[model samples]
Target: MTRILQLTDLHVFSTPGATLKGIPTRECLEDVVGYIQANEHPFDHVVITGDHTHDEQRASYEAVRSILTPWHECLWQVPGNHDDRLLLRQVFPCRSEDGPGGTVNFVFPAGHWLCIGLDTHWPGEVAGVVEDQQLNWLQEILQQASQEDVALFMHHPPVSVGSVWMDAIGLNNRERLEEIIRADPRIRLVCCGHVHHEFQFRLHQADIVATPSTGIQFSPAGTSPQFADESPGYRVIELNEHAFTTRVHRLPVIKYHPAPDA
Candidate 1:
């Protein structure tokens, strides 16, 4: 079995002492990283689903680089609404058969899995979109990998997570995305971040898995923005030849945060 470690929504700020939604975001992220380092799981790859920086500052990105430096060669990153695409590309450069652009989309091999990273971020917008260029590029990869199963990683969830506000800011062109996904029988899993809460939905023979934020988790269910009193978490996925299994690993002690002032 091949194991992949996924950590998302770090929201690391320009300063190490920053906080997000009342949780010490930097410290929380550190805890998650420490856990992975101490654990016995040997990950084939470390996939970060975006929101690497809360402020999108150079310093913030630098902080992120420092945190993941240990696994630099095995790291894969996608940009979130809050991230700077250029900065992300600078910090985590990977070989892509697809030609250059501000958009970062690429495909690579991870053990027996064909891993694909899609960039859905739109500058200055909370929502995301899979543009025509990216769509076309992905279709080509799908055709080429028709004989093998692929796992997609993106910053935004293509499906709604039952949060009215978050859904409003979800991938704007998911219908097109869904069409592409439906066309490819090789797609087995779609892992995403952005909602900062865990969710799963199966579509087009693929499992859409959303991981919780490593810093602040959003309310499990809500229309408006609300922070949840939950521990930071990550996902551990084990992929075998014919099947794959995954589970969310949250901190043992739940961290409490008072509801933001209305």
Candidate 2:
């Protein structure tokens, strides 16, 4: 079996002890990483969906790299709205296939699965975009990997998760992306970040799921953005030749809580 760990929304700041919405992001990330190292088995692939740094600075990226050193060799990443693509590439050069300044997308094969990471980052915008270029690229990849089951990783969800604020800032061109997914039966799972909460939405043959952040947790209920008083978490995905399984694992305790009106 091939095991993959999906970690997202690190939001580490350049300043070591900085916090976002009252949560010390770097500390939370360190705790999450430590917990994984202490409790889980080695993962075949460590996929980070995005939002690596809230400040998007070189120092912040480097700090994130240091915390995630254990899985660096098996790491795969894509950019999020809060990320600086160039800085991220500079820190983790091998994580993306793109050049100095290109969309950070990637693809690899694992057992009977074809794992693909899509770049949904839209610079200077909170919302994400799935351009025709990416769609065409995905089409070509799917054609080539026709025989294998597909698992997609991206920063933004292509479907709404019922949060008015989050849905408004979701993938802008989801219709076209959905069209492509509907045409491909091989696409079995689509794991996403950006929502900063756990959610599952079925899109035809694919299970489009959103995972919790490794730092801060978001509430899915409010019309506006709201923080959840919950522990940071990660997703574990186990894949074999014919089947796959996944679950969300969170820290046993909520080390820090968000301010009620932050």
Candidate 3:
């Protein structure tokens, strides 16, 4: 079985003072990294689904690179709404000179599985778009993929998760994307993030799962205030041939006094 980890919406910031839970967002991400390092699991590959930085700040993006480089020994990433493409390119080790926009999507073989990472970021917007190029590439990849061994990772979940605000920011071209996946029997699972709460669904006959943020979380059932008191977390996905499993772990932290709604 090939295990892949997904960490998302980190929102690493430079001057994270009183705005972010009285703690630096970087610290929260460090906690997640520590948990992954301490909790022994030889993940075949790591996927940081997006929002690696907050406010699109250069320093915040650099902080993300600092936190993620050690893990880059086995990792691939896609961008998010809060990301700046130019800065992210500078941060990631695999600096691509592919095209003018620097698309970071590709297919890779990992032992017993075939995985594809798709870049879903749309500049200055919360919603995502796959565009024609990504879709064409995806179809070609899946067409050539071994049956029952393909998986996909993206920054935005394709299905709506009942969060009105979040739904408004999901994949904008989901129908077209769904058409591609639905036609391909080789696809085993679809993994994503951006919505800061854990969400799951069956779309295009594939399992779609989104991990909560490593830095913070949005109340699973809410509409305002941005984040909730939920623990920071990440997903460990076990991939075996045709089967895939995800286990979510919450980080350990001491909050100030009583947690709201505790």
Candidate 4:
């Protein structure tokens, strides 16, 4: 079996002590990283969907690079609504360079699966869109994939996740995206970030999934925007012949403690 790890919505900041929703984003990421570092099972690749930085600052991305560089050999990423795509490209040059007009779209190999990362990031907007250029590119790759199982990773869910607020900010061109997915039998899974909550469902022949954020999680069942009282989390996926399995792992909430008048 081929193992892959999915980490999303890190929201790292340049300031080491910076917090989001009352929790230090950096520390939360560190906790998740620490757990992965201690795991016995090795991963073939690490796919981070998006929102790597909350402030979208150079320093914030730098901090992200520092934390992830150790596993750089297997790291693959794409931009989220919160990310600066140009800066992202500069910092993480490992993405597919042959995409249409510098769009962050590419197909790579992960075990027996053909992994695809799509850039749904719409500049200066919280919502996402898979542009026409990206759709053309994806179609080209799908044609080449043949019968190989393809795993798609992006920052926005292509389908609604039962939350009205999240659905509003979801992929704007989902109909087009879904059309492509329906046309391609090789596309087996669609995984994303941005929801800050774990979600999974089936879309025709594909399994759609979302991982919880490593920064702050949002309430899963809310019709409006609200933060969830939960800890940071990530996902582990095992790809086997003709099938796949996954599980979401969350770090236990760490209560803050003050140093006594030191």
Candidate 5:
């Protein structure tokens, strides 16, 4: 079996102790890393879905790199709405070489599964877009991997989780993406971030999952955006020959609370 750890929505700032809606993001990430070190075994791959830095500055990315040094060799990433693609590629030079432009995507093999990270980031927009070109690319990749079960990782979920505010800013062309997933039997799992909460949805035969942020938590109960006073968390996925199991692990306590107006 291959074990993978997923961390997302870091929202760290260049200035070290900066806070996002009252939660110190960098410190929260540090605490999450410490907890993982103390309680969990080493992961084969650490996939960060997106939102590595809030400020999109070089220093912030460097700070994130420092915090995740232990998994540097096995790290895989994709950009989110809060990220700068060019800056992220520069900080982590081992990513795909799609020149200096276009979307940032990745594909790798893990056990009996082929893991693909889709770049859903649309520059200058809170909502995401998965263009025909990117979807075509995905199809081509899937065609080549005829025998391997597939797992998709992206920042924005392709399906809505019933939150009015979040669904408004979700993947704009979800129906197009959904069609692809429905037609592909190899796709068994889809992991995502950006909602800042834990959610599970079924898309045909695939399981679409949304993980919580490493910093602040969002509540999906309101029409408008609402913050949840919950501890930071990460997801653990274990894949074997033809099946997989996953679970979310949170920090022992809630260290910070979101401001009412934040």
Candidate 6:
């Protein structure tokens, strides 16, 4: 089994008091790092789905880079709705921008499983897009790897997850994405981030998995203001040649403020 850990939507902020909806973004993110460092299960590979920084600020990038430094040995990340591709590239130079099939579309051959990462980030919008260039590149690779079962990762869920607030910002062209994915029984699992909670749904014949953000978790499967009282979390995955499995974990966080002055 190929052991993997996925953390997404971290939203790391440089400002001491910065937050996403009072989520204590930075403190909570460190807590996630703490959890992984203390855990017994060492990840063979780490996939950070997106939203690595908040406001596209240099400090946010620095904070995220520092927090995830432990996994630099084998880290793979994609851009999200909240990320700037150029900024991300500047931060993680090891990642290539070989257009569609270059850095964004990558493979892990050592694990005996074909894990593919896609970039679905679109600029200046919460909704995502997989443009023709990316789709074509993906198809070309998928066709070439006909014999391999794939574990796909991206920044956006190609299917709607029930969080209405988030659904409004999900993949805008998922049907197009579906058309490309549905026919491939070779796809074992699909993983993404952006919902700020861990969720599972079936898309076509594959598992559409979403890992929680390192910042704050909206309530699990809630509507309206979007989240409830939860710390922060992530997903751990174990993949075989033909199948993959995973579990999500939320770690305790350092509260930055006292109880709301209700």
- Clashes (backbone N, CA, C under 3 Å), per candidate, total 0, 0, 0, 0, 0, 4
Using lDDT, rank the candidates from best to worst. Answer: 5, 2, 4, 1, 6, 3
> For model 3, which pairs clash?
none
The sequence of per-residue lDDT tens digits that candidate 3 reaches over residues 41-68 is: 6777888888888778887877777777
Predict model 2's lDDT versus the native: 0.91
Whole-structure CA lDDT of model 3: 0.76
- Against the reference, the lDDT scores of all candidates come to 0.82, 0.91, 0.76, 0.84, 0.92, 0.78
- Residue by residue across 1-262, what tens digits does model 2's lDDT show? 9999999999999997788988899999999999999999999999999999998899999999999999889999999999998898899998778822378999989989999999999899999998888888888888888456999999999998899899989998889999999998888999999999999989999999899999888998878888889999999999888688999999999999887554
Task: Compute the lDDT of residue 79 as modeled in candidate 2.
Answer: 93
**C-alpha RMSD by candidate, in order:** 1.9, 1.4, 2.9, 3.5, 1.3, 2.6
Q: Which ten residues in a row have the lowest lDDT in candidate 5?
A: 95-104
Q: What is the lDDT of residue 110 in candidate 1?
A: 60
What residue pairs are clashing in model 6? 218-227, 218-228, 219-227, 219-228
Q: Positional deviation of 218 in candidate 2, in angstroms?
A: 0.9
| TM-score winner, 4 or 5 | 5
TM-score of 1: 0.93
State the lDDT of candidate 4 residue by residue for 153-241, as single tens digits: 99999998888888888888789899999988778999899999999999999999999988777876657778767778899988887
Q: Candidate 5, residues 12-31: lDDT per residue as tens digits?
A: 99997899999999999999
TM-score of each: 0.93, 0.97, 0.89, 0.93, 0.97, 0.90
- Candidate 2: residue 79 Cα off by (Å): 0.5
Model 5 residue 67 CA deviation in Å: 0.5
Comparing 1 and 2 on TM-score, the stronger one: 2
lDDT of 1 by residue, 1-262 (tens): 7788899999999887767766778788878888778874678788888899999998888888888877888787778899987777666666322333567766767656788989888889989988887887888777777346789999999898878888989998789899888887778999999988899999979999999999988875567888888899999988787678999999877754534662
Better of 1 and 5 by lDDT: 5
Tally clashes: model 6: 4
Model 6, position 170, has a per-residue lDDT of 79
